[model samples]
Each structure stands twice: as C-alpha cells, then as structure tokens.
Target: MITRILLAVDDSPAAMASARHAIELAACLGARLHVVTVVPDHSLSNLVTRMGSHPGVHERRDQAAEAILDHVVRLARASEVEADAHLLEGDAARRILAEARSMHADLIVVGRSEGLDRSTTAHILEFAGQPVLVVPPEVR
Candidate 1:
C-alpha cells in the first residue's frame, strides 16, 4: 500500500542510484514519488568571502537543494511517474525525515556513499525508525 514514496537524495552517485531504484519501485506500485534534497547550511564561497562564514550559508544550501530537486523532477518525468520535488536546508537526515512526514510518505529511500560518511548514513537509517531503502553507490 505504499502509494507515496519519498526519496532523500543528494548529488552523490549513491543517491542517484537510489533515485533510479525509487523510480522503478514507484512505477511498479503505481505510487507517487516525492523527491527531496537537503543541503548543509554552509557555503564554501561565503565562508571564504565574508570571513564570518555566517550569512548566506542557508541560502547556498537552499540553492544546492533546489538544483538537486530539479534533477529529481526531471528524472521522474523521464520515468513517467507522478512526482514532485522539494528543496530544504539543514542536516540531510533531519530534513529528509521531516519531508517524508510532511508528504505522508509510506516509505523512504536513501543512498549510502562509499566513504567515511557511510557510517553517518547508517546512523540516519537507524535513527529514523522508518522503513528506508538504502541503495549502494555501486548499484548504478
């Protein structure tokens, strides 16, 4: 009965893999896809320019999120699924969880990168306590 599925994606290879998997699943289940991307509230450019590294951190993060969101929307359209996209700023896992709840998603899909960040991603899956699909980076 997973009519609504949320995909928590970044621009990583693993995330892209998960997005593709989510597309296939959505098509199979006749589900709607809710694609969301989160950017950390910090910008390298602002950090270097302002020296304060405070202003526009959120802004830059939001911009990155928007780009990822747009990518997801395009993916959905190509896949021929009813889909929508969201851009948010904050911790990736937190924003993803929030978006899933707000969208009333029946399931969530995330990607696991092949680096030190993998443990952090694992922690997200453990902490979220919701059904999550973890796509490996090599799956693509």
Candidate 2:
C-alpha cells in the first residue's frame, strides 16, 4: 500500500503527465499526494541584483507554482484523493530527493526528458534511494 507519494512537477508536459499518473496511482492505492515544485534560485533572470531583467521574476515563479499546484489539487479532488502541494527552491534532483526523505514518501514520480537515453536514465536511477517513476514527455 502506497501511503504517500511525491510528484515532482515543473513547467513541462512530462511533469504534467507524471502528476496525472501519480494522482491516479495514489487514488488507487489510497495514498496521499504531495506535489513539489522547485524553482531555480539563481537562474539567468533571477540574478538577485540591481541589473536583473525582471523584478517580478520570483513573484511570477510563485504564481506559476500556485497555478500548477491548483491544477494538481483539482485533479486529485476529482480523483477523490487527499493532496498537498508545495513550492520549493533548489536544484531539481537534490530537492526532489530531500523532500521525499523529509516527507517520508513511498514513491517519487518525476518527468524525464525523452532525449535522454539509457546513460541519463542510469544516472537518475543511481540518484534516487527510493522507487522512482520517470514519465516521458509523450505521456504528459
């Protein structure tokens, strides 16, 4: 029985697919869904200096996270599963792994780039200490 699930979501088709799949699996297994969205803290436009291009970048990222969370919530509700969403800041892989450990997640679902072949898949496979379900973009 999967009691808790961590769905790593981002602004990508593959992530959306992963979220949907996680919701379905969680609902079927009577598991609670936890959506984690991470935004890079030091991206190009988010230099955090006077010359940064957009001052509202963080706000925009937050809004995007909120929107994505809302969508996940709506999906989970439709599936009759309890769901919680969170906005985090950090590197993608590290944040996902840390959240899984912190929240005691039974499974971690992530969206994988289709272009990455076996090598990348192996690399990701080695990173997760828990079961990881990597959904490709086509599924999203």
The count of backbone overlaps in candidate 1 is: 0
TM-score of each: 0.82, 0.85
lDDT of each: 0.80, 0.80
lDDT of 1 by residue, 1-140 (tens): 89999988888988888998999999889899998876655555556558874666655667777888888878888889899987776677777777777777789998887777676577678766468888888632
| Per-residue C-alpha lDDT of model 2 across residues 1-140, encoded as one tens digit per residue | 57999988877788888888898899889999999887777564457635755588778778988899889889998999999899888666677788888998888888775553334345546877778898877721
Task: In candidate 2, list every pair of residues with a backbone clash.
Answer: none
Worst 10 residues of 1 by lDDT: 40-49
- Compared with the true structure, model 1 gives a TM-score of 0.82
What value of lDDT does candidate 1 attain over all alpha carbons?
0.80
CA RMSD (A), model 2: 2.9
- Any idea how many clashes model 2 has? 0
Model 2 CA lDDT for position 34:
91
